[model samples]
Target chain A: MKKRSALIIIFTLIVGLSGLSSKTFAETAKNNYRLYCSQCHGLTGNGEGIDKPTMGVAPKIHNNAEEMIKLKDADIYTVTAQGGASVTKSALMPPWEGVMSEAEIKDMVKYLRELCNCTEK
Target chain B: MKMTKLTCLILFSLALTLPVRIAAAGDGKTIIEKNNCGTCHKMEGPAAKTFAEALSRKAPDLFYAGSKFQEEFLVEFSQKPYQIRPAGTLYLNHVKTVDGVDRIQDPPLCASRLSKEDAVLASKYLMTLKDPDMKIGVYKPGASFFKIGAKMIFTKSVACIGCHQVKKRGKIVGGTSGSSLYNAGSRLNGDWLSSYIRNPHYWDPMSPMPKWDLGEHAWMQLTNYIMEMKE
Candidate 1:
């Protein structure tokens, strides 16, 4: 009975720690989105950004459910890190690999999913 | 007794002239303070840590203005201020989208043009504030690099035009997210420009500008080409 209680405590602790870590990651990804992407990608992920006026190619609307739902999560990550040009898109969207870490980029992709409210494959 | 008298006389004379010397230096500073220039421009260091704070900044930080800008350019610009950043410093503040078209809604201009006398004094005072860590004399003008190479690097690979405005075909074209580089040669110090282009993160970690690794030679070529853009 005592061993079972200890096991329960360990499991609870593990769950609690993971929840906290994920929350932290969400916060970090939100901050990064505002800092870097918000200029070309609107703060609300509506594609109407400050740089939209000057850019030849408009920034993609992350909140467009239909459009965003079509993009695979991995493709989103590549676009964020490698820029649009790397994927044969517009060159205006700059690569963020130098500015952000790999982990941060992954978190950003997850945040995009959250923004788009896209869970369906 | 003679020696003491001589020393006293010298000290008294020196004391009489010291205030005049001090007043000369203080004139410019006094004008700046009286004008309340610090209200808009940041006179201190430690660039914004968060994007929120960066967006809140009303004007560019003037703490390192000495290293960043030229005295003549500052004086001229102060006297005749014009819109440089089309969307403003923090474009997120001024830019608005209507009917799927992004428009700069009544973009707030910089602090009104200073009077000729005030411009001279304020520019002089601004020149006193310098970043000690920033090195000078690194970028040499007239490096004899092909202009086309720099143009290609700026527009294509590095894509500086995505943010900054540059003169192309005698017309200003490029993005408005960053300060216009049409006459960057006249406005900025060559060494400071080179240092900034190489590693902007060193100055502002939260800078919107991306860090590109285009090698040393390419960076210099780009720098030299920019340096030649004298208005």
Candidate 2:
């Protein structure tokens, strides 16, 4: 019984640490999103930002789950890190690799999934 | 009190000149305020409050006008207003879809042309409203060697090309969401450009552009690259 209790405590600690790490990462990504992407993409990921009208082409509406679901995770990552021009999309989406960390970019991808309410295929 | 005639003459002369100096210096400020230029422009302080307010702003922020504009250009522009932003200050308000393609309407007219005296006075007053924190001395003038690297930074690193027009291969190419930077070198002061790049929020709180954490070297190089773009 003593050994079983020790194992349970260890298990709880591991789970709690992992949860904290993910929550911290998610918060960082959300802050970065507000600072960088929210301007053109919008605070709610609706793509109806102040710059939307000025853009010759409308920004992708991230909240549209149907459209977001059609895109692969790799495609979204490429567009976010390398910019829209990398995939022959609009040149307006600037590459963010230099400005953000690899970890942050990955987390932002997760956040984007959350915004779309969809998961990677 | 017994005063020498020379002392009295000097005192009288000084009083006469003081009023003339004050009139010359204060005329511009009075003229600007009298015209109600603030109705369309923010002559001082931060930008609009909300996104909706930002979109509805009729004119550009004039808080940094003293730093941003060339005096000669301002004077002439005040007398004979011309289109600066091809899509107007709020492009969304002026955009219309035609055959599935977005078309920008003609820019709105500026307030009626001011008389020559008023234009000059207004320009002089406007030029005095500069941002002191805008560091212009860090940038060396006419340094065009960094064009190759700066172009990469502008296009790939920061994606400024997405919204601003820049000259490439002897042709203009870029997004039109922001004003075309093709003539920025001639149109805007390098100092104002650097300050704007450093912190756009300082001038306009509601500006849609994000705050970039670019170091001094990066921003100065970018400024040089922008200033080199003329015509």
Candidate 3:
């Protein structure tokens, strides 16, 4: 009876820990996107927003998965942090590396892949 | 007998001259360049005479303005400027390199900074850009093709109708990204229109319209269609 109870408790702990970790990751991803990616890239990633009018270059719609697939995690992250010019895209996209934390950038890269349904290696 | 002959002659001459007096008179080409139209727009081809290629701009070219805009409409739009056509503004920054990237060191300058006289003169010059090369095409005016064409422009192609006002069942609808197309036919030229649609960035460096890969028929058709927009 004691061994069975102990085993049950251990299994519950593992399940609880896994659930919590996933929840934390999700929350972190949401925060990263809202803070860094939404300005020019847009909340829905449609490339249309208040920023779209004034932007010298229109940001790509992240909803297009095929286009997103061509880009890499490092490329997206560098673009997010370094601005569009760094990636040789548009100066309108400002770099966010100094503005955001390293972990936050990584979180954003993952967030982009998720939002666009892009595969990341 | 002499007085009766003189009166008859005067009456005939006055009748013939009335139509000419009623018509609008102005030299559009002289008006454009004198007013510094080149600052925002590039009507000429690549700068060959100059030592360096002028920084590429974003405003659409006016090289074909004479061929595009009708005279009365040009005078009217010049006097009362409004964002009528809804084509996307041509302000996308040209990427100097293959990656299509550059650093924006400063914000763009607004015309508000200019004096009132300068603004009026600039507006006057912009009114004169009619493309001389635009000969009327074989397409019938007010044909079903134009409606079908405008529909395609709004839907399948650049999706310009999302931001611009195109005639829809006689009602105008769309966002104001650039000017409205309700008056584009009355205000633009065919050759300039074709060149602009082919490459919007060639004229204006700061425009947001993407360089779409369109074919010759579509380009000519769209240009011809837009030139007929008179109010």
Indicate which candidate wins on lDDT.
1
Query: Where does candidate 3 stray beyond 4 Å?
Result: A1-119, B1-64, B84-146, B169-171, B190-195, B199-207, B213-230
Provide the lowest-lDDT 10-residue window in model 1 chain B. B95-104
Candidate 1 chain A, run of 10 with poorest lDDT: A18-27
Ranking by lDDT: 1, 2, 3
The whole-model lDDT of each prediction reads 0.79, 0.73, 0.52
- Cα error, residue B89 of model 3, in Å, equals 5.8
Model 1 ranges off by over 4 Å = A1-28, A43-50, A53-58, A85-89, B1-25
Error of 3 at A35 (Å): 22
Top DockQ model: 1
Ranking by DockQ: 1, 2, 3
Candidate 1 lDDT at B213 equals 66
Residues B74-171, candidate 3: write the lDDT tens digits: 45445554434222222123111112222122223322233343434434444444434333453444544455775575444545543455665788
lDDT of 2 by residue, A85-115 (tens): 6798876786666555578888888888999
Instruction: Calculate DockQ per candidate and list them.
Output: 0.28, 0.09, 0.01
Task: Give per-residue CA lDDT, model 1, range B1-231, as digits (tens).
Answer: 999999999999999998865664478678777777788777887776565667678878888888999999989988788887877867777766677655567667776478887787778778878989887787887768877888888887777887788887898887777888888899999888889988876666567777766788898888887778788
Per-candidate TM-scores read 0.80, 0.65, 0.42
Error of 3 at A91 (Å): 25
